[model samples]
Target: MRGCSRRAGRAARKRRQKCESSIQSVSLGHQLQYVRLRKFLHQRGFTSSLLQPALFTDTGRGLQTLKTIKPCQLIISLPESCLLTTATVLSSYLGQYIKSWKCRLSPLLALCVFLVCERHRGEASDWFPYIDALPTTYTCPAYFADGVLAVLPAGVRRRASEQRRAVRELHSSSRDFFGSLQPVLSQPVEEVFTYEALRWAWCSVNTRSVFMSHPSNNFLSGQDHYALAPFLDLLNHRPDVQVKASFNDATRCYEIRSVSGTVRYQQAFINYGSHDNQRLLLEYGFVAPGNPHSVVYVDADLLCDVLRGDRSLDQKRKFLKENNFVHNLTVSSDGPSWRLMTALRLLSMPQTLYRQWKAVLLGQAVCEEREEWSVHTAVTLCQRLLQDTNAALEKISDLLRQCDPAVREQLDVVQSLRQEERCILGRCLEALRGTVRQPDEALPCQPDDNDDDDAVS
Candidate 1:
């Protein structure tokens, strides 16, 4: 009975996994169709005002209503500096539909509304309910790097500009060799990058380095013991910039050592963009902070300890919860504890996450060191586990053929977890396989009424 139950559960789990995969593919197809229709409208020069799709409630409405009673609206979420470009693009392409956007909202307010509307439009795929009331417009000023924009309160706008200049001065005075380079921000975050212009800015004076970049074109500049390079910049901190770099006088450097690994230095640059334009530019570098003397690497265990105890995870959970998503239970502390971090990464797979949790609690699994591990470690782990389990299943099949009833029963339990690729099951299977013998003094076995059990024997 026990063996039969285990096999039944395994079959059910396999079926569930298969069902989920099918659902995902269907969802993806629906998304693609929606995107196609949206792009078609966009290419046809439908401005935001007139291009807004018919409300989900209005889907059945006739074309006459869409042409006449269809109210036009617009919203923008990016920085005010970005608004001119956005407005120009939409207004120019929209032509006749341009005048319909006269909702009399501020440039800043309009931007935020536009972003919210656009984002929510695709939430339900085909369903689009009317937004009877507009959401409150967020008017806080912000600063933009290549594509990354940092929001700022009205109070910080003035200080932000001053800080940007101060950062530039620090970089200009630095004498370090590699500290002079600047790297571009990674993709997607590049929206903050604009050709050139400074607007409302807040400078984090406490920031360690400076960065410079432009969105339209890839240009990276860092100074003040700060260095930024494109792809290299992605690798935490390792500076590369020759002398004669005008940003700073001397190269800057910082001590980097942590329990987890190297403590990469992160610095921000603040500089004046266009004084008349009222824009402040900030750049981040990973090298040295205010002081650069000699390089030193030490055991950064203390840093790691601080990270594990950090309350940032709680803050992040709150952020996600407020934003409508369920609280993300997984996070990595910037500490020496690889165990939690590793488990969290693996738990990203919803199907096997519960087993991962059990393993973590049991101390059977830990955060595997990946500093030296190749970038493909996660993918490799999944593939290897799959291959190994399949082989184990085949071996178990042979054991059953050999008429090893005890072995077959143990394999039955193992097979359930193996089929689902449950990590904890793998650990459990290995432990059981290593055990020399089952507990002794077995009770007399009960005889089954069915002859099937004896038939197999």
Candidate 2:
């Protein structure tokens, strides 16, 4: 048995090497830009021999391992001088203007401005190789077309709208700041800092920047904490990978170490936090098909609508709001989230038992009858959500047929989001159904001598 196990392991290793060779063979066509980026990084003292840029079939472009990485191994250590931070912008030729300008600029805005300016410089800019490698456009909700945005779940759609508005407002408010940079530019400020240019730069920073804390700087408005880590940002997000990333004070480099090692030739990933599909789609422009953290949110207003006939609606709403349970009510595969179930329990209580509301909130066992009502309410809400999800999916399907390829891609992302929500709702509906008990099986609540709360009219 030991001999057979050893032979099996050797066979598996051989299979991995063969598969990796095929992956590398196909990736050669896509390495031109990355080759330039590598040379640029090496010139500036950035080194990572363990991983190389590769076009992955599953994750598009990401860092691939050349050898099997062991747990707790340092994956990449990027030198501080190579990072594009607000400090980098401050020290550049634009520094004097930024410092002398009467108006203060935000750290994020400064990064965006520096990115646009550097991008405009083309091959003339020292950072051109890095800039050239970035995606020309991003799929972040800010870039989603109106028709596509309309199909997103209501909660995500609202947040996307807010993001778009913020970007537009930022562009509008920076006209004076852009004008101030005319001294450093050969072209007019209007031409160099066009809205489209700024939008691209804004999305680049939003999607790719790493959080690195820097001490207070008077020239910048907010905290100087964001840094755009080149090459390192190529490590795509995986909801399951465990990694430790931070700026090493002694090494003077930003480093990421793998807690869960990756096998040879596979895409090496880093955790971008435990983000749900909605958040990942909104901010990163992609969806993890089976993200463990995915959930379907129950909108507060929708919950109220479902319990519209309840007499204690006003009181329950006030209580839920006061207790800070008014938001983040959700449904997962495991059934209703605690907050959602708790809210439903309070809403399920009859007016006669209004005084027992505190007990219910405190997690005291309510009468089985009340519990049944709460389960029934949850079933009805989940049914409504499922219906809405189905309807939205139908609309998306129709839109997919009529839209062009570009629009179809965006619609596809929204479709994935709705479909994931539908699955969660189905699971919740199933779980809620199983918990529901018939009225005849319900037991009476024990009486409390101090109160008559158990007596139902």
lDDT of 1 at 436: 23
Question: Per-residue lDDT tens digits of candidate 1, residues 1-457?
Answer: 0000111267865863454234211111124433554344344332222112221221111001112211121111111221122243234322222233333222222222223223234444221211111111111122222111112212223444455555344333321211111121122322332211111111211121123221331111222222211111111221211111122213221111121211111111112121111111112211121111111111123222322333343443343344333311111111112333333332222222233434433334332222212112222333444455567667656655764454443344334433433343244334333322334633212111111211100
Q: What is the TM-score (0 to 1) of candidate 1?
A: 0.16
Error of 1 at 79 (Å): 25
1-457: candidate 2 lDDT, tens digit per residue: 0000011367866974575456531353246778888888989899777888777665677878889999999999999989999889999988988898898899889999999999888889999989998988888887888988788877888999999889999999999989988877879999999888888999999889998998887898877789999899988887766899999999999999999798887778898888888988988888876677889988887887877766567877898888787899898988988878887777766666777777777776666666777777778788988998899999999998899877887887888889888988998888887687666775322122123455322
Query: Where is the poorest 10-residue window by lDDT in model 2?
Result: 1-10
TM-score to native of every candidate shown: 0.16, 0.89
